[model samples]
Target chain A: MTINPKAKLEETQDGTVVYNFDPLIVKSHYEIDYVHSYAQDSEFFKALGRQELMGSKCKKCGYTYGTPRGHCMECGSETEWYKLPNEGKIHAFTTCYFGGEAFLNETPFHLVLVEFEGVDSLFMSRIIGVDTEDLYVGMPIRAKFRRNLKLNPTDVYFVPKA
Target chain B: MKNKGQDVYMISGGVTKFTKASPEADFRLRTKKAFDYALNDVGMTLKDIDGSVASYFSDHFQRQLMSGIMAQDYLGLTPKPSKRVEGGGATGGLSFQAGVEEVASGRMNTCVVYGFETMSHVNTWKGNEFIALASDTNFDYPIGGFYTGYYAMMATRHMHEFGTTVEQLAKVSVKNHGNALHNPYAQSPMKITVEDVRKSPMVSYPLTRLDVCAMSDGAAVAVLANEEKAFELCDNPVLIKGIGTGTDTMRLSDRPHGKVILLPNETEADYKNLKYPGVHSFRAGRSAAKEAYQSAGITDPLEELDIVELHDAYTSSEIQTYEDLGLCKYGEGGHFVEEGKADLKGKVAVNPSGGLLACGHPVGATGIMQAVFMFWQLQRTIKKHFKDDALQISNAKRGLIHSHAGTGTYVTATIMEAVK
Candidate 1:
C-alpha cells in the first residue's frame, strides 16, 4: 500500500515531469482489492439465474424499484421482492467509447437506461443484439440474462424486443 | 438589503492561474499564494482572519490531511478556529458558505475560505478513476457511469425530450471559450466553433471531448466578513445577499429517467410535476435557487440578476442549468443559448469568467473561482486585476453563482450584490 518516494522522474519537452515506478516493486508493495456484501438482495440474483427479473415493491406506497433494495427510499417501508416483466423501453442511452480497466475489452459499448412499464425508477444495462445507430428513446427492449448468474448486476442486459 | 440581520459580505477574493497541471506546486504553496493574495486584496494580514475553512476534494496527490490546520500553520495563523469542508465539486461553495455562516453567526468576525486541487500527480486515467469515486460504486462504476457518461446520458435524454441539438450544446463551449479569451487565468482561451466541438473526439455518445471541461490544477480563496467588518476592511465589498444548498439522490437510477416536458401554458405546479425527470441536477438547483432567491428577495432572476456563473462541467450542464435556475422556461435552454440570450451581451450574462468549460475545473477550486469571478465582476475591478475590460459586465450590480457536485446530488447557489 505504499509507493516509492524516490521514484525516478523524467521531464518531457512540454515541461511535464513523468514519474517512473518499477511495476514489479510497486505491485509487490501494494494490492488493490474490492469487498462487499449482498445480504439484502441475494435472492434477487438467484432469481436472475432463472432468467427472472425481480424487483422490490414498498408495501406502504406500492412503489416498485428496478434494482431490488431492502428499504424503499420514498416510504421508508421494507420492500417485498416481486417479479418484473422482461419487456421495457429505452428511457435514455449512450455509447461510451472509454471506460476503466474492467471495461477496456468492451469499449465503444452501448449503455441504456431502461424503464420497465409501471416501474418507478430506471436501471442501467448494456444493450446487445441491436445496432448502435438504431437505438432511440422509447424503443422497446427486453431483459436478456447471462447463462450463469454471478450475483452481479452485469449478469443481466437488455436488447431490442422486436 | 432585504435580509437585514443575516447579511454576509465578501471583502476580497484571489485565485491562482488555472492550468493543466502544477507539478511544482503543492497544497502548501498553492494555499499560501491564494491566502496572501486574498489578504493583499483587502490590505489585511492573517491576524485579521478569525476563522478559516479549507476545501480540497482529495489528499491522494499530496498524501496530506487536515488541510485547514495545515493551511493555518503554513500561513502562521495559530489558535484560530479552522475547519475543512468537502462536497465533491461543490467543495468551494460549501466552504465559502461555511465561512459566511462563521462570520454571520457572530462566532467569528472575519473568515477565509480557500479551495485547492493538485490532480496532476497521477495519470489521466487514474485521475479520472479518482473523480469517478464520487459516483455510487455499487451501481454506477460497474456500469461505466462516470462523470462524462452520467452527463452524456442526461444530455441524450434532454435532446430526446426537448429536441436539443448537438449544435446548441456546442454553442455553450463556443460562448464560454470566447469569454475566456479575455480572462488571463483561464486554462483554455482558444476560439472554437460549434463545428469544432462537433468534430472533437467523442468521450461519450453526444458528448465530444470539447463538450467536457478541462481537468485543471488551481486554488482560490475568498475573505468573508460581517457587514460592519467588511466595510471597515475593504472599500468595495460585495454583499452576500442569499445562500442556499440542496441535494438529490446519489445514485442516478434512484431518480426519474424518462423525459418530462412542460407545455407553454403550464402552471408552476404543472411544470414541476411534468417537466422535471429527476435525473439531472435541475431539481437540486431549483431547490437551492428557491432558497437563495427568497432570502435575496429576487422575484425575477433573469431580470434582477446582472450576471451568472454556472458550473458548466460540461456544455450540456450549462444549458440544463439555465432551465434549472429558472433563467428561462423548461426545454428552452437549447434555444436560449442558440439565440445568444446567455451570451455576455445577452439578457443575463452567464460564465463571463469563461466558466468551467474554458476557465478549467480544478475540483475544489472551481466554486471559489466562480465566487471570485463574481466578486470582481460586481466590484467592476476586472480590468484592474485581469487587465481585460471586454470580459467585464458593464454596470453589473448583482450576480449569482451556481455550483453542483457528485452526480447532481449537491448544489449550492449564492446571490451577491455590489455594495460600495
Candidate 2:
C-alpha cells in the first residue's frame, strides 16, 4: 500500500521532521479505445510505423493531449491530429509491489507520470528497460511504441529510454 | 469557552466489544447491539429516542440512501428524522456532530447516532473500493490510491521531511496496544513493540502492517439530548460544552503549499520562535483542539487536561495528536510516550480505553466512541490507574474529544464537562 499524497507533515524546532511518503508515477500506454479509434485513421497509424509519436491538439484551447480524442477535455471542442513533442519529463512515479490493471502486464511495473513539454496534463504509462528503484522526479524521457500482434502492427506503447 | 446556546448532552451511549469478525451479522444487527447497549446505559429504550442518525463509511455495507431509516426501523424507533452521515474513517466522530446538531438546534429533544460495519464478511477488494471513495475520485482514483497508499505517502513524506523514524511511529502502536491489553472491548489487544512494528511486513514504504488500524466488525452508538432534558433523563450526564469543525481542500495536489500545517508549536511563545521538526500534532487536529480548549476555558492543555481519547486510526495520527492536543511540546510526542506522560497513569492519560489502533475503527462510530471513553474516564468507571480525580486535578471539570475526516481534510473537536 502506498501513502496518500494528501498526508500531513510536521517539523520541530530541533530540526526533526515528520511526514508521510507517498510515491506515484504516471506512464504512457495505448488504451484500447485510443488504439481502436486511431486504428481506423490509417494516416495516424502510419506515423507510428516511422517511430513517430502523435497526439491531438484542441483548436479551441490550443491544448495538446496524447490520447486520440473526439473532443478536448478542457474546452470540449473537436480536436485534430497533430504530432506531439517526442520528449517528455517524468512528473511522478510509484513502485507497485502488488496488483496492476488487467490490461497492464502485471504487478511491480514502474508506473510513471509523463508530461509532454509545456502540456498542462500528463499521461500514465510503464517505465521500461531501467531499474524502477532508480526512477526519480524530473527524469528526462522519450516515447516509444511496442506493437501488439493481436492488434494492428502500427499499435505502439511508450517506453522510456535506458 | 462560555457554554454556547447549543445545549446538546449525551443522554445515552453504547459500543460493542470491537472484534475482528461478526459472521452473518449485517450493520442492522450490529447497530441494534450498540443502540440497545446505549439505551440501557441511560435507563431508556429505543422508543425514547426522538431522532436518529447513523454513520457508516460506505454504501456497500448498508447500501442505499435510506439505510439510516432501515436501521432505525429495525430498532423499532418511531417516525423521526432518521438520517445518515459518512466521513470515511472518521464517520463515527462525524456522527457525534450530527447528533449534537439535533439537540443544539432544538429541532429534536434527543438524537441517537449509530455506526457499524461488518467488514470481515465483505470482500476485501470491494471494501477497499469503498474506502478509496474518500479521496477525490477524479484525481486520486485513477492513480490506484487507497487508504494504504494515501497513508503510506504521508508516512513516507513524514519520514523524508522530518526524519521521523519508523520506530517513533511504531512506539504509538506499542503503547496503544499495551493500553488495549487492559481494554476488554479491544479487538487486537496483544502486546507489541517498536521492534515488532519495524519487523512487521510493509504495507507501504515506511509504514508497517501494525501501523494501520485493523479492519474489524463492530458498532458504536451515542444519544444526545438538550441540556435540561439530559440532566433530568440521565443521572451521570456528560454535558457537551464545545464543538469545532473545519474543512481543508479535498485534493492534495490542490494544496501546493501543503495545506497541512501542524498546530503552532505551543511550547514556543512565538510561532516562528519554535524550531521545525519537533514534537507536535498535525496542524489540522491542533486547530480543532485549540478551538475546543478555548471554548472550554483551557489555556494549558498539558497542565490542565486530564484524560484523552483521540483518533489513532494510524500510529502517526496518535503521535501527532500529542502535540496537537498540547499534551507536549514539539518533537516531544515520542518522548512523552517514552516518559509515560500520556500513559495510563501518566500526567494526562491518553486512550485509557484503548485507541482505534488497538480498539477498532467503525468509521462513523469513532467520534462518539472517543466520547464514550471520556465519559467512562470522567466518571472513574474504568478499573485503570488514572482515577477519576485526574480530571479534577486538571481542573477536572472538562474533557475533550477529537476526530477528523480523511487525512485531515475535515476535523471535529469537542469539549465535554461534568455538570454539577
lDDT scores of the candidates, listed in order: 0.83, 0.65
Label model 1 with its docking quality class.
acceptable
Ten-residue stretch with the least lDDT total in model 1 chain B: B257-266
Q: Residue by residue across B10-88, what tens digits does model 1's lDDT show? A: 9898899999977676767887898888898779976788978888887654446676677778877777888889998
Cα lDDT tens digits, model 2, A1-162, are: 988998888765764233322322122222234323433245555676666665677889887765345467557898787776767876555454432122123444455545577554455445666665576556788776655322242244445655
lDDT of 2 at B8: 77
Off by over 4 Å in 1: A1-30, A39-42, B1-5, B60-63, B257-266, B269-275
- Per-candidate TM vs. native? 0.91, 0.72
List candidate 2 stretches off by more than 4 Å: A1-162, B1-3, B62-65, B256-283, B329-332, B383-397
> Residue-wise lDDT of candidate 2 within B1-420, one digit each (tens)?
343556778766677777776654666787888788778766886566788788877666434456667788888885777778877666777778778877887888888888776666444554565666676543354445555555555544444444566678888888788887767777888687789998987654455678878777877887889877787788878787777666544543222221234433343343444433211225556667777766666778776667778888878777667766777765556667767777766887777666888888766667777877776665445544223232222335566778877767777778777765
For each candidate, give the interface RMSD after superposing the true interface residues on Cα: 3.7, 10.5
Listed in order, the DockQ scores are 0.35, 0.04
Expressed as tens digits, the lDDT of each residue in A79-106 for candidate 1 is: 9997888999888888888755456567
Q: What share of the true interface contacts does candidate 1 keep?
A: 0.49
